[model samples]
Target chain A: MSDVKTTALVWISPSTWPACVDAARERAPDDHVVLLHVGDDRIAAEAHRAYAGLLGRGHGPERDPGSRLEALSGVAGADLLEKAAHRLGRPCELLDRHGRPQEEVIRAAADADLLICARDGDPERPGPHSLGPESRFVVDHAPCPVLLVWPHRT
Target chain B: MNSLAAEIVSVGLLLGVLAFAVARPRGLPEAVAAIPAAGLVVVLGAVSPADAWEQTHTLLPVVGFLAAILVLAQLCDDDGLFDAAGDLVARFCGGRPVRLLGGVFGVAAVTTAVLSLDATVVLLTPVVFVTASRVGAHPRPHVYACTHLANSASLLLPVSNLTNLLAFTASGLTFTRFAVLMALPWLAAIAVEYVVLRRFFAADLAVGAHPPKEAEQRTVPTFTLVVLGLTLLAFAVTSLIGIEPLWAAFAGTAVLAARALRRRRTTLPALWRAASPLFCLFVLALGIVVKAVVDNGLDTGISRILPGGESLTTLLAIAAVAALLANLINNLPAILALLPVVAPAGPGPVLAALIGVNLGPNLTYVGSLATLLWRRVLHEHDSAPSLGQFTRLGLLTVPATLIASTVALWGTLQL
Candidate 1:
């Protein structure tokens, strides 16, 4: 175990980018921040191929699906984390994990003192007040205390 | 323990497992939660070992059929058929947003009717979203259409849904007769859906169409298209010959799998991964659980409440109840519980129940597995529709479609 502490683990998605930024802003200057984004490789590959097909292509690139999705999510995460770190005037680490969003988030939260996430609202609900399946699971099972940001106002 | 207490304990245990399966926290696969519950039933003597074995026998065909359809859908996806269809839909719109909505409805209905609702949710949703994005149209209307039409439009053919298959088997109607009876209801349901969806999504539907960029354009596979057409033809032919439809589905799956395998487009392991045996296990376990409930006198009350005539009033009443039950529990379990009750009333009521099970799930998030799967798909893609939004839409559309389709079913039966 390293003597240095990683205080907060923030789960970021394209939808939760703003909430993640807000969490980063709230962190103490000495607090170590690790921002994580989880993406489904299969889904990303499907979307990629579907996008390529829509553009008159037969298939997507023949690269490894897992790495491609990881890279894509990594880039998106790094971009947002970099912006957050620059705003906080400190360095932040971007962690990209591949799998179901809730599972990966729960696994990553084991090492952190605090987990920060936004309620990913369910589409069936009228407003952003309701919690999504992933967010609900994270709040319930994350190893550390969770700070859930409701970014969508009533 | 006394036999009575044991039975009660077993039933309670099974329901708990089912609730977990339905809630599916942490995204546990349905099969993973269900199979163990099934094992519990046998261990508790809620169902005898022999009865459990018999249940497996009954489930094998349904599993095989669903697995085959799933494989076919995945392979078709790998072949870029859905994307090609999506492109065609965009082209057909010719840059109009409303037309794009219409195009999406048509393609989604056909996809749901042919490939099953799950397939539409899995394979077509992303394409719909991407297409909507490309055109700069509101993705909500187009993307939402995939889930709604996937449920409402699936009432048309027996192959369109698992619930429909159950009803078709119970109806004792020939395949052609079943389609004939459902044809009007299917049309009526789709019309009601179109009117409601257009109204609710009116603001979102009004956008300028943008054609697909050069990169998204691809040559559609003419051979695959032909094969799909022939496979559909084979379904009709198999039905006419008194052969089970699963045979045709299996044959079609084999042909498609062979082609995809030969071309090195897909692998055998991919097939296994695509189809979950755990889901089959889940269904079988649910059956045993439902059987335990039914054996404990659930059926007596159900049969009493079931409408007893072929009259339009009776059909409507039965459908209303079925829809209510489906909304309360899921349609799969609802259908399992109520099938015996409805089947006794004749084909008319059986089908009316089918209509309810298929359409009623649109009322809530947990009403059907397909809707849950649709939600998961949207979440994965970073788009979430609020539950209130879904419930509101369901409130508006479900009753209207249910009534319209039931009336249509009555009229068809009269004809």
Candidate 2:
């Protein structure tokens, strides 16, 4: 049989990046790993709404705090992805995206053989409660197999 | 139509508008709900066109002030006044979380008192959050200070809050007098807020001992600060000179907008948008809707319930009722509904109601637009406080502030 290298996708978040990176390093050391971080725009949208609600609409893109915030988030997401890549210690593709985190993760995982992620909530419990809505959505709808791990050792 | 039908239609329309505003369903602008509801009230004969016109006339100055202040606040933000303030706070705090909290409190109180609570919530909250994070301090206490002071510290001046603007008009107190009268109550409320918040977030403030990595130096926007100071002084000067404070607000906005445009910091369209014509329209429409409700006898109902006296006990009762109404139906509408009834009693009850509507909103997110916006800011930072946590802190702070401020108002009126 011809040997084909497996490709793995790891979802990295501020709280769960360490655990996901560890899992990727341990289980898929020989595989091609893609580190993905999605910057959620909900905060920017909320900021726009707040500016409009009280201060009135029509704040141009330059003056809008939402735009600046989105820029900041982008910088932050890039930094996170860099950190994750460094921890992986092997050659990896770093992917930075902006949108709904779960949807972005799912879409990024379509071509991968396996997806690695960490449970984002209730780390002490081992039930549905351990996963947040985003993680739950990713695990259920991922195009590839998911390796869900706790954010920390339980 | 019949009196009963008019009352039902007016009340129903107002409630519908308020619900839309509070829920902001599907992220619709409040004007989308308020404008149509206002038109419906007029179309249904619940309010006459002439009555709507009169209400608009009465609200002209308040709306104008609001628009100018919004523009002014936007320009100040664009000029980096808030960012500079954040940098200053960070350096002043020297990486101590407790000191950062106090710095936030001082800046937030002064910002609210001078620039209005909208500025504090929209412009200052993010700045404070960024400052706390940059200084390696837990942001919870500092950011919480911003929202709490936006409400509690807004009791200081007529320009500080929309409710105060309305109450200022109704009370017939000069600009200086309004500030003088409210100063004591404002201080009391701020003191109570600081104490309660310090205690409530004690644990969060206890951590974060690391100093800033490299305290990025930002130059304070001296021009903007000077203009803001001059504008505040102009507020009192114009009030003393027998002109509406809107002119001062407009002049200040014009000066700042001109400077911003000249420096290419903002576009003309951005300046126009900053004036927030749509929001001003919302307030006018809301005023018309509220006027219809009052004319249909909401004022009479409130009058029957409100105690009639300037005594300390009576003032406390008025404040309590105002706080309850504010929490029940949002501060803007609550003040709109209560003002007519309270204004007829005298300046004492009107000021007391102002205290209640301003400080009372800290009790719930729905109680004020500022609180709702503050929540959005926190959510953006991924630090939104849970509803239970917010309510628990509110429970500790709101009543204490409300009562303390009301008592201070009573004492001020005596003096």
Candidate with best lDDT: 2
Interface C-alpha root-mean-square deviation, candidates in order: 13.5, 7.9
Q: Write the per-residue lDDT of candidate 1 for residues A1-154, one digit (tens) a residue.
A: 6778658887765434565667667754456888786654434533332222111111113322322434544555565566555655667787877666788899999899888887665333445335655677788899898887754321
Best candidate, DockQ-wise? 2
Q: For residue B84, what is the lDDT in candidate 1?
A: 90
Q: Report residue B315 deviation for candidate 1 (angstroms).
A: 1.1
Model 1 bad stretches (over 4 Å): A1-154, B1-11, B23-28, B48-51, B368-385
lDDT, each prediction? 0.70, 0.79
Off by over 4 Å in 2: A1-154, B25-28, B213-215, B368-385
Work out the TM-score per prediction.
Answer: 0.70, 0.76
The native-contact fraction of candidate 2 is 0.06
The TM-score obtained by model 2 is 0.76
lDDT of 1 by residue, B293-326 (tens): 6655667767778758889888888888889877
Tens-place lDDT per residue, model 2, A1-154, is 6588899999987545788999998999889899998876554554443343343332333555556566766776787788788988989999999777888899999899999997765555567666666788898999889999876531
Among all candidates shown, the one with the greatest TM-score: 2
Interface DockQ per candidate = 0.03, 0.08
Query: Whole-model lDDT for model 2 versus the true structure?
Result: 0.79
